[model samples]
Structure formats: C-alpha cells, structure tokens
Target: MTGAEAEGVRLQKVLANAGVASRRVSEQLIVEGRVRVNGVVVTELGSRIDPENDLVDVDGTAVQLDQSKRYVMLNKPTGVVSSMKDDRGRPDLRRFTKDWDERLYNVGRLDAETSGLLVLTNDGGLAHVLAHPSFGVTKVYIAKVEGAVTPQTVQRLLRGVDLDDGSIAADKARLLSTSAEGGGSLIELTLHAGRNRIVRRMMAAVGHPVVELVRRQFGPLHLGTLPAGRARELTKVERGALLTLARQAAGDDTVVRDGGEDPHTDQEI
Candidate 1:
C-alpha cells in the first residue's frame, strides 16, 4: 500500500459512513468521477482523504462527513419552550429529543405560543450562522389573527410598520383566508426574524393581533406534512441544503462542527 493511502482513511468508507450509500455504491460513485475532494475529482478506487480537513461533495452538494454531527427537524407543538431545558419548568424540547443519543439544541426559537418547523442540531457553526439575525436568514409564518384582514392591512404589512423598537416589514405577506366563525384572518408572512416576538408584534401593530402563529419554513427548510409534536432526522438532501445555506450565511465554505458553540442558539423568533 502507498504511504499516502496508509496515512488517510479510504474515501469510499467515508462516503458510506456519511450516509451516502453502501461501500459498493460509494465506490461506483467515486470511480465514476461523481465525487470531488477539495475541489478535485478523485476517481481512483484506492483514493483516501483526511476526513477532518478535506472538503468533499457529491453531485455538487457539500457532504458533511462527520458521523457525530446530527440535524433534526421538529414540529414543535404550542407551549413547548425552545431550549433543551426550561428554567421555568415548562414543557421543553427534552420530550422530543430524549431518545437521541447526541445532545441537540435549537438553532433559534419559536415563541412558546407558536408552533412549527424548528431545527435542532449539534453542529454549532451552522447554528451560529442560522440563529444570528445578522445573517438575514428568513422564516415563514402563518398567523391566524383577529378580525377580517383587509387588502389595506396586507399592503401595510408588505410596505412596513413602525413598532416601538423600529420599523419592520415582511418580505412577503398575503391573506390566506378568513374564518367565517370567528371573523379571523389567516395571513402568511415571510420575514427575517431579527427581533423578539416580531411576528406577534407586527400583527398587533397592524391592528390584527395574532391569535395563533406557526412557522412554516426556515431558510431552505419546509415543515412539510410532518405531524405536530413529532421530530425527524433531516434527509440527506435536507442536510445538503442546510450546509449550503450555512456556507452562504457564514461566508465560509468550510464551516465545521468545531467552529465553536453558537451563543445565539437560544435567540427567539
């Protein structure tokens, strides 16, 4: 065996263990020039790589080869706090995550009264990029608010509204429907979650206080049909999307687990 191969782990094994596929399929992918290491196509069957330092991608999507790094999506039900543990002793994230072996934490937060897509991961670097408002990562929310919302209200939301802290606006706002029974309106608003209770506050400022709110999307992730109170590990495609966004948000393509703990992990939406 060459010293280079001896010094590094087999590339196929790395890909397979990273959930690319089985060893045989990974070998096929490598031999077919479908895998790249550090920006170079590596087709040799005996190819090996420094798993920790080398960047790898398959079919143009960056692959996170660390086995310990986990990304999970939870459909957080209303009333559960966004932390691993709540100091107030309220329903917390632990109930949904207790079964996982790795310690996962929320990338950001949804208000206790709100529910929907929440990302939990052990990858601190990605969390930092995603949680910090400075990155301008946007979230989509469907808020059911009081009273019949008019076209004027939607236009106002799209234009901007002044709150006590500052002026805020939705990137997109559309009236979804109106409740005939309660005379409430369902409005979908997409905006950067840059402040505390921004959605509820914005709705209140528009004279349609939110009765219920649920986040439907965060960055590139969609809540989909995942049931409330259930959590699922992100699929390979989803992981790739997140890694892509993290790279864009952090302005670094080589973001890694050891990038450091995200201090803004608990930042609320």
Candidate 2:
C-alpha cells in the first residue's frame, strides 16, 4: 500500500464520518470530481486522507467537521411541513429551530397533518442508520381513526395492509383507547419501515382512515410533554442511546442510504 493509503482512512469514509453524506453518496461526490483534498482535486476512488492533516473540500467549499454532534427532538405541530423550506409559503420546521445556529436536517418525517416526535440532527450517518428499515429502529404512532378500532382490525393491521405502493405490516398494533364523544378510536402501532405516509395509508386501507396522527416515539427518543412547535437538544443519555443504536446497526450492515430527506415524509398526504 502507498504511504498515504497506509496512514490515512479512505476518502469516502472520512466524508461519511464527517457527516457530509452517506458513504455511497460520498463516493459519488468523489467520482464526480466534487471532492478535493488539500487543494487538489482527487477523483480516485481508493484515495485516502489524513483527516487530521489533509484539507477536504466539496464543490469548492471547505468541509468542516463538527466535533460535537447535535441531536434535537421536536414536538411538531399540525400544518407545518417537515422540511427545511417550502416553496408555496407554508409553515415549515425551520421556524421551530430558528434559535439554533447549526444547520440541522430532519432524521425522519412526519407529514404536515401528523404531529409528534421528530428528530433533527447534523449527524448524517446516524440519521441514515435510524431512517433505514434494516436497522429495526421502531417508530411509534398514535393514530386517531374515523371508525372504532377493534381487535380484529388490529389483527388485520398486524397481518399487513396492501397500499398502492406496496404491502406493509406494523411491527405491533394495539387499540390504545376509544373516544365516545367523537366516535373515534386511538390506535397505537409501531413499525420499522420508513415508506412515505405508510402509517396513514395502512390504516386507511384497513377501512379505518386516520383522522389524526401523532408519532409518540422514534427509536430511543420520545415526545414526552414537549410543547408543540418547540424543540430541545437531546439529553446526553438520549444522544448516547441513539449513537449506540446507530453504531450497532451500522456494524450489522443494516444501514441504507437516506438520500438526506425524511424517509417517512417523502409522500404527500
């Protein structure tokens, strides 16, 4: 091996570790000649870099490695898009994070009509792992449906529902409670899939269209009493748990490229 290759890590791995993108996407950047090392354009796939000594740039902009990772939990409110920006002038998640200076992206997604736990972070690698279905990071949602949810309906949800996109089964499905006044039912279900609008579509397909939806949990984080439209940094314990989950998932080769968008919010409601 060459001296540089022997002493340094692969360029793509370095970029992935630094949160530029997933390893696969980082390789694409390298191949496209958008990545440079120490002021020199380096397009060789097997190129290595001494992260501590070599300068890395993407598209002529310096790639700054964040020593401290940021993880945030937000209780998203209804009618707010899960994205950073919206062209139609609708309210977006950025308003909730305006106080924070860090450039953060949503880890997963909650549609504008669904309100609940949403994670925001600059840690692309962790986000990629958490969003990928293979990681088995469970997302818990409490859905209020139009009709009464019964054990039979719950069983059907557990069995799986076929949507136009594909068939999806909930990891766990149970009736949490029922509302007599509104003639609705509260059903809680957990799933590892990140397909766009899968929860809403699944319930709708099962003959109980979701009237309201809220994500109560995402992996190790919970939406415990955080006011709607407010966001807070992840506690050290929460952050550690998430990092550990991501690391374990990555070690198992369960991570899939996230493409830097909220996996669950890719489809419009």
Candidate 3:
C-alpha cells in the first residue's frame, strides 16, 4: 500500500467529525499553522493524526472528538416541512424532533405533500453519502394515483419518461393491491432518484397524476408500524446496518453479509 494511503485520518476530517468546527474552518487552522500534533506544528492540509493516540491541540485547547453519533427516524406526517427551520413559521419536522437534546437535521427531505420514514442525523458525512445519487440509495413509496392502472403504463414507467426537469425512470414499479373504494389505485414505486416530487411527476407523465404519496423505506430502514408525527432514535443494529450499507454502496469490500441486504436497488413498495 502507498504510504499516504496507509496514513491516519486527515486533521480537517477528524476536526469536522469532532464537531470542533466545519471542515473548511479546520483547513484554515491548518493553513495558519494553528493546529498541532503532539506539540509539533503541522500546516499541511493532508497532515494525519490518530485521534486515539495523538494529542492534537487546536488554538491551545485539546480537541475532543464526539463519542456518540445521533441517528433518528421519523414517520413524518403530511403538512410538515422537511427543513430544519422554516421562514413562514409553518408546521415543520421540528415539531416532532424538538424534544431531542441533540441538534439534528433531516437526512433526506419529503415535501409538504408527502409523508413517511425520514432519517435525521448530525453526521454530515453519513447524510451526504446516503442521500447523494451516486450512492444509489433506493427509496420506496406507496402512491395513490388519480386513475386506474394498465400494464402498458407500468411498462412505460419502468422504461422511463422525459420530465420537464430531466428524463427520469423508476428503478422498480408495481401495483401493490388495487383499491376500488377510493376510486384510485394504490401503486407502489421505488426509485433511486430524489428529484423534487419525482414520484408524482412520474405518475403524471404516464397520465395518472398522484393524489397522495408516502415514503415507506429509505435504504434498509423502514417506516414500519410507526404512526405519523412520531420520531424515535435508531437502534445500534440499525445504525450499524446503515454504515455497512453506505460502505457496500461505495464499493468497500470490507463489508460482510451481516444477515441483511443493501437497499441500493429500489424495490416495489
């Protein structure tokens, strides 16, 4: 292995993970040579230090890394904005998470018209890795459309459609159980893309605009039987599963089977 590849963590990354400051702020400290490792000045951005063994001090104070990483899952109900703060003072996801002692932000967003499993975390790198399209985290949703479904429509959706924003397609699509009571069909769709209102727009393009939408799953995490407007912390196993999935999706070969599958491939809701 290359010497650089075998080196310890970057000072900026460790500081950012420590929540001492943003990665950019840590980089500035390095550039200004305000950061030291074991009583020695290290100004290079690529400078590495082991958080456990190295005594790193920033601005004369020892930097303490954060020990616990917060992970939360919420069954977000409709009419709540997914943002951390809303200028309009409208109902938002904060209503459910305000009780938490830790500061948390939405891992991914669901619009006001949509609802269901939303993950919230303080780990910015984990959030970015999971939510970014390159990771291919499949999101599953159950949607109520305005009309009846046809086989041809399903084929077209799977093949993809040209939306105003860009051409998009579902990774998987299937009508779960049809319902005649609501005069609309309850269809399940799974897609890897997170475009604004992509599910609704995809259905609209196929002549069946969405009437209601709810995200049922994100990665291996499910909304499950959780009621709307409630939020809870993810268990240790779930958190580990997420980290494993992220590594697997990123092409990390160190991941084991661990008795569960990665949610990179979108499944029918």
Candidate 4:
C-alpha cells in the first residue's frame, strides 16, 4: 500500500471515523482507560496510531475508520429531548431513530417545547462547524406570539434584547403569512446564536412571549416537505450545500469540488 494510505492517524480521529461516538466521547474513553493501543492501556488523549500498523482497541474490540459518511435530517417532533439518552428517564432524540445501530448525535438542539428540522450525523467536523456560533449559520423560526407583533417589537428584536446572559439579536425577522390567523401572529426570525432557548427568550424579553415556536430552517437545510416524526438521509447535494453555506459563514472560500444544489434551497426562507 502507498505510504499515504498506511500513515499513522490520531486515536480520537479514529474513533470519530469509526462512528462509535463523537471526538468528545473518544477523548473521555481515553481518559477513562477504556482505550488500548497495541494491548497497552492508553489513557493519553493525544496518543496516535497507524490505522493499518497499529492494533487499537476500545473495550477490547478493534475499530476501523469508516470511509462512508452518513447524514440524516429528522423532522423533530415536539416533546423529544435533544439527547441520545437521559438518566432522568425523560424523552430523548433516540426514540425517533431506533432502527439504526450506527451511533449518531444531534447536530444542534431544539427545546422540548419547540419542534422542526434537526440534523443527525457521525461527522464530527461537520457537527462542530454547524454548531459553532462563529460560523453564523442562520436558524429560521416561525414564532407564535401571545399578541400581534408591533413595529416597535420588531425593532426591538432587530436592534437586540437584553437577556440574563447579555444582549442578543436576530440576523433578520419579519411577519409571515400563516393559517393560524388573528389569534396569534406568525413572525419569521433568523439567529446565528445557539444559546439555550434563545429564540423563545428573546421574544419573551420584548413582552411578546412566544406561544409556540417551530424551527423552519437551519442554514441551507430546511424542514421542507418532510412530515413530522419522519426522517431521511440527506442527499449528497444537500450536504454539500450546507457545508458551503457554513464555510462561507466562517469566512472560508470553499468552492464546490462537484455536485449541484438541492431543489429545495428556497425553502429555508
């Protein structure tokens, strides 16, 4: 085999590529002495091993890097927590995809009271990029407020809201035409920040408490025609589009090596 293909790779990256868990979890495994390199217990997080030359084991089983990447989009239904599991016995995101044995984690979070698009994947780099606020991925939400949104309220949201953490603002927002009618107004809001319940709290701070909220879009990814409680693997074009948008947000000039855009691109707006 070529030297490039036989070169040594890092332990944490191997675990990440194996789809066993995230890089964070792999590091934890190293710290907990659950990982071994060549039969020697390895607790060092920085340890490296050659995929073909080294015998790296986690819990006594060998792990090999997964060349095939998987990306899934779930229309997260309300009441499911954004976790693989919970000790409090509360509902978790795992209930939605019980058929898969491959380890996958949520790309970002949606509160128990909120619902809509959620990304699941084993790609650590992609997950980190999407979750990082510095990437400025615009998350679009349709918020149902207790009363009609006034111009003043819109101004407050656009300018910024003072939360306990500090000032927060949306990238953009405007009233939307929805079937809910006059009881409550539907406002579309965009934010790059992923603070805890940020969208709900921001509107609440302006005296326009949200009655219901649905995340309609995340960057170039959208809920589209996917019905609630259903999910599908992301198409190659969709995945590339999301990566391009995220890279652009991070000030990177990532030109598409290949593939076209998704037909559902406009759904994010």
Candidate 5:
C-alpha cells in the first residue's frame, strides 16, 4: 500500500461516515461503480482519501465529509433583519445563532418584512452557488397582496413583466386564496428571481401590491412547519439533497441576471 493510502481513510468508511449508508452497503456501492472521487469513478474498496481536501459523491450526489462544516435551517421571523448584527439597533439574527459555536451566516437574505426559510452555514462554497442568480436555484414564497389576485394576474406573472431593472417572470405562480374581509389574496410563487424586492415589485406591476411575504422553500430544502424565529440542524437526508443541488448548480451555465449574489448580505424580499 502507498504511504498516502495507508494514511488516508478507506473509501467505504468515508462514505459511511458521510451518512451515505452502512459500511457494507457503501462497499457494495463502490463495487457497483456508483461512487466517485474528484469526478473519477472508484470501485476499489481499499481506496482511501483525505476527506478534508478531496471531494466525494455517490450516484452523482455530493457527500458532506468535513465534520466541522455546519448546515442550519432557520425560520426567520418578520421584523428581524437577515444579518447577524444590525448597526441601526434593529433586530438581527444573533438571537437565533447564539446557541451555535460556529460562526454562521445566512446563505441569502429575506427582507425584514419578509419571513421564512434562510439557510445558515459556514460552508461558503455551497452558499456561493446557492445564492448566485446564475445557478437558477428556485425559491418558493407565499405572499399576501393588497388586491384580489386572479387568473389574469397569475398569467401575467408567468408571461413576464417589465420592471425598472429589467424583465422578470415566475416559473410558477397561482392564487392560493383570498381573505374575504381584508380584500387580500394569498399567492404562491416559484421562481429563481433574486432581485431586491422582486416579489413585491412583480405583484405591484399586476396591481396587487404585496402586504406580507414568506418564503417557504429554497431548492431542495423546505421550511416544513418550523415556527418563526426557530433554528435547527439539517438532517442527513436534507444535507445530502442540499449538497446535491449545489453540485448540480456548480456545473450549470444558465444566465440569470437578478442581483444580490452575496449570501452574507441581505437583499431580497
């Protein structure tokens, strides 16, 4: 055995530790040519690698190997800024992250008035791809708007509308329901738009200004009934899905011009 292989971790053990499966199952997967390291297929059970430095994947999905890297899902509440600290004394995210020892930051912003899911993590590479508009990662949001949202409004959102910045469109948009007394409507939108206050702008263009907005999903991750202002560590399956999304995004060449690519900064509605 080479000195480096002896010093490194076994492939199956690495996969097992990464939560892919049991050691035996991981070995079987390797033998079946379902594992890869640095883009090269590996079927050798005895192969070892530096988990900290080498990238690994099983069946085209990425595996999180670094134990120190943390992925957190937070249900951000309205009236709190998407930052860890607020210079103007406004409420920030410090309270939610106080229990964590690691320095975590939001992967993308949700406006102070907009509440819902925000991915908090120390993994900058994954955050970069997730937050970048060019990756075309879809986000789901439910918005309460001022007027009655009709099928025409949904069609407008799907067909695209011109804004001050440029033209924009939602991958999917529908009127979920309407409030009988308040003359407000709930609309759900699936989009990859990252422009500042994009949802508000789009609704306003359709004559239904948004009154409240809550993002419910980001890529493969969902808010899933988590109460506002709470945070939790991601499950193994969630981590696998998230890492897989980021991996797929990294190789995409689609051009998306929406702004706010920096995950550390808050910029969307």
Candidate 6:
C-alpha cells in the first residue's frame, strides 16, 4: 500500500462517516472490541484502516463505505412512537423503514400523539446538525386548538410563552382557519425550539390547548401529501437542499443556497 493508503483514516471516523453511528458511539464500539480489522479484534482508539484495502468488520458485518447516503422522509401517523424499536410493543417508526437495509435513525422525534414530517437518515452529521437547536433549523406545524385562535393569540405566541422548561417564542404564528361558532381554530406556527412536546405546550400556555398538531415542514422538506405511515427516499434535489440548509445553519458560508428557499411560511404548508 502507498504511504498515504497505509496511514488510512481513524477507525472511529471511518465508522462514523460510513453511518454506522456517531463518532462518539463509534469510539465506544471500538473500545468494546466489537470492531475488527484484518480479522483481528481491535480495541485501540487510534487505530486506522485503509477503507479500500483493509478488511474491516463490525459485529461480523463487513464495513463497506457507502457511496450513497440514505435520507428518508416519513409522514408519521399519530399513536406511533418515533423509535427504531419499542420494548412495550408500541407501534414504532421502524414499521415504515423495515424494507431499508441501511442503518438509520430519526433526526428528531415526534410524540405518539403528534404526526407529520419526520426525517430519518443514515447521515449522522446532518442528523446532529438538524437536531441541535443551536443550528436554528426551523420546524413548522399546523395546530388545531380547542379555542378560537384570534390575532391577539398569535401576537402572544410571537411575543413568547412561559413553559415549565423555559421561555419560548414562535418565529411566526398566524390563524389558518377558524371553525364556525368561533369554537376552534387551526393556527400555523413556526419555531426553532426542539423541546419535547413544545408545540403542544406553547399552545396550551396561551390558553388555546392543542387538539391536534401536525408538522407541515422541517427545514426545506415539506410533508405535502406523502400519506400517513409511509416513507420515501429523498430525491437528489431534496437531499442537496437539506445539506445546504445544514451548512447554512452551521454558518458555513462556503456552501451556496442553490435557489432552495426555507419553507418557513404558512403558504408552504
């Protein structure tokens, strides 16, 4: 092997880049001696392998460097848990991803009662950026509340709401539609917070108590009419848009937007 090939990349980094797991988790796997190189168990953290020439395996599965990453958008249905597996026998996101052979995990989470766009991917780096609130990745939701959502309520939501966790504010909130007799209303809200049940908590804090909440868009990807409980691989254009969004959120000016706009407005839902 050439000197450059002999040097190779760090084993953990190779595993992470291959979407086996996050870098930290990959290190854990290495330390546990679950990773093998050239048919020998390797637990050294600094070990490196030429992915092209070295025989690397994790838990008996050959670690082949994937040229194509898998990115899936699932229109999760209510009552299904956003998990790969559930110990309590609850419906899980796995039901939609069973056909996929590549290892993937949900980017973020949707509670059992909430439904709509949930991104699942084998790209750990992108998933980390999208899930981190510091990235300011916007998530838009349409909330049907128990009370008539007035202009004042939208103003209140924009101004901020106090939850048990902390203060939270919506980037934008507007009434989409209201039921007759002024009993209930469908309101569109946009926010960057990733706190658990944040949308439901925010609406409840404003005395409007969410009756049904559906995420309409995540970053540049929209739920559209994808049908509930079904998953589809993201198109090349969609994947590029998501990566662009992640780069922009990370303050990486080197990457251009490529004419893809952030789906932050109510009209995009």
Question: Which one wins on TM-score?
Answer: 5
Alpha-carbon error at 16 in model 4, in Å? 25
Assess the local accuracy of residue 110 in candidate 5 as a C-alpha lDDT between 0 and 100. Answer: 91
Model 3 alpha-carbon miss at residue 64, Å: 17
Q: TM-score of every model?
A: 0.88, 0.70, 0.69, 0.67, 0.90, 0.70
Candidate 3 lDDT over 155-261, as tens digits, reads: 88899899998898889999865556658888889888867778888898998888889999999899889999899988645665676576557554222112122
Q: lDDT of model 3 at residue 67?
A: 49
Q: lDDT (CA) for every model shown? A: 0.85, 0.78, 0.74, 0.71, 0.84, 0.77
Q: Indicate the residue-level lDDT of 60 in model 5.
A: 83
Residue-level lDDT tens digits of model 1 in 21-129: 8999999999899998876889998888888777788887778877778889999999888888889999999999877898888888888899999998888888888
Pick by TM-score: 2 or 3, better one: 2
Instruction: Give the C-alpha miss distance for residue 257 in model 5, angstroms.
Output: 25
Native-referenced Cα lDDT, model 1: 0.85
Which tens-of-lDDT digit does each residue in 158-269 have in candidate 4? 9999999899988898977434455877899999887888888888888778888888887788889999888888764576566555444544422211112211111111
Colliding residue pairs in candidate 5: none
Report clash pairs, candidate 4.
Answer: none
Pairwise TM-score winner, candidates 1 and 6: 1
lDDT of 2 by residue, 79-110 (tens): 99888898999999888878677788887778
The TM-score measured for candidate 6 stands at 0.70
The better-scoring model by lDDT among 2 and 6 is: 2
Model 4 CA RMSD to the hidden true structure, in angstroms: 13.8
The C-alpha stretches of model 2 lying farther than 4 A from their native spots are 1-66, 179-182, 252-269
**Which residue ranges in model 3 land beyond 4 Å of their true spot?**
1-66, 179-182, 251-269
RMSD of each: 2.8, 10.7, 12.4, 13.8, 4.1, 13.2
Q: Point out where model 1 deviates above 4 Å.
A: 1-6, 43-46, 179-182, 261-263
Which sequence of candidate numbers ranks them by lDDT, best first?
Answer: 1, 5, 2, 6, 3, 4
Q: Candidate 6 — which residues are off by over 4 angstroms?
A: 1-66, 180-182, 252-269
